[model samples]
Target chain A: MATRVQAAPFDLAAELAGFGQGPKVGAVVTFTGVVRDDSGTLRHMEIEHYPGMTERAIAAIEAEAAARWNLVDSLIVHRYGKLAPGEAIMMVATAAPHRGDAFAAAEYLMDYLKSRAPFWKKEFTAEGAEWVAAKSDDESALTRW
Target chain B: MIDVLYFAWVRERIGLPKERLATSAATVAELVAELRSREDRYAAAFADLDALRVALDQELSSFDAPLAGVREVAFFPPMTGG
Candidate 1:
């Protein structure tokens, strides 16, 4: 298991190269979040995170996923700082002995990461910049777990 | 002294990223009360406790959590990470 929090972009191909190759690992799942300009007025996004808390919070969520699923391996990579639209924001990968476990663990990790992590996003637009508000749907999604 | 950090709109509203404060407040709620009493910016930023979240020593914590031996405190809105 690994968790990386950095300002630099990550290579998706390189990260998945040797993901889960062991005999015990039969399935692998990955999810990537990208910066979207749905409104077309977005210029860039600024992702602010608590320097010391972000990593710790992600690690804790990763641990919970591991305990809940039969995960053979797991990885979470999140980026911070200013990013343009179309850039990748974060990614999560999970490997398990079966497809069910791998898929479920990946979704669980995403639900927790969305609300529990200590990172915030601000969108810069032609008009101005505004902090993104936490969605009630995201919070409600956690109740399923 | 406790290191107080703010993020996102909270930092923007308060016009600061971090500060070191010498406070006699015993819990997160008391510390917030002390800060809210200081200036209009703080009062505005901390006006709605329900809209804000607090962390003690970089860990998510409740407002009533004790401040004894805690070196850091942070206040911000609910996270919107993914």
Candidate 2:
């Protein structure tokens, strides 16, 4: 598995392909989250994370995914630093013997990540910059899985 | 002794990004209460405890968690990072 937290842009195609290997693994599912322009409603976003804790959180989430799913491999790439609208923010890919595990693990990983990760976003909006709040729905996603 | 960090609005509220603190408290909640007494900046930052998230040694943790064996502590807004 590959997990990266960097400032440079990532190649989803390369990442998905790199994670796909062996005839036993027939399905690979990936999710990419990007910063949307939102028609200028959001000027820019500042992503804040604790250097060491952010990684540890990601690793813990990945470990949880591995335990609950029949996954062959996984790649979680999350970028930090200032990001503009329409830029890729993060991606999660899972490979498994079947599409069921791959998709389930992919969603499970994202759901756990959204609710538990140690990162924050400050949005520069027309009203002013504000720290985004935790959404109940996002937190609720973890309950189903 | 522990290195504490604040991020985003939490940092803005505390008027600092980082600081080294010496404390006898055993849990994150105690440490926050101590800082809240230092000044209004800290009080405002920690006013809504539920909205904020805490990390011990760079891992997500609860407020009641002990500080024993901890080297770092961080507080920040809930995650919006995708």
Please provide TM-scores computed only on chain A for all of the candidate models, following their numbering. 0.98, 0.93
lDDT of 1 at B17: 98
In terms of lDDT, which candidate is strongest? 1
Instruction: Enumerate the candidates' DockQ scores in order.
Output: 0.93, 0.75
lDDT of 2: 0.85
How does chain B score by TM in each prediction?
A: 0.98, 0.97
lDDT of 1 by residue, B1-82 (tens): 9999999899999999999999999999999999999999999999999999999988999999999999999999999998
Please report the TM-score between candidate 2 and the true structure.
0.94
Backbone clash count for every predicted candidate, in the order shown: 0, 2
What CAPRI class is candidate 1?
high
Return the DockQ of model 2: 0.75
User: What are the per-residue Cα lDDT tens digits for candidate 2 across B1-82?
Assistant: 7999998788887888999999999899999999999998899999999888888888778999999999989898878656
Off by over 4 Å in 1: none
- Screening candidate 1 with a backbone cut-off below 3 angstroms (N, C-alpha, C), the clashing residue pairs are none
Tell me the tens digit of each residue's lDDT in model 2 across A1-145.
Answer: 7678887788887777667698889899999998876557898887777777778778888988889988889989998878888888899999999999999999988887786776677788888887678898998888898
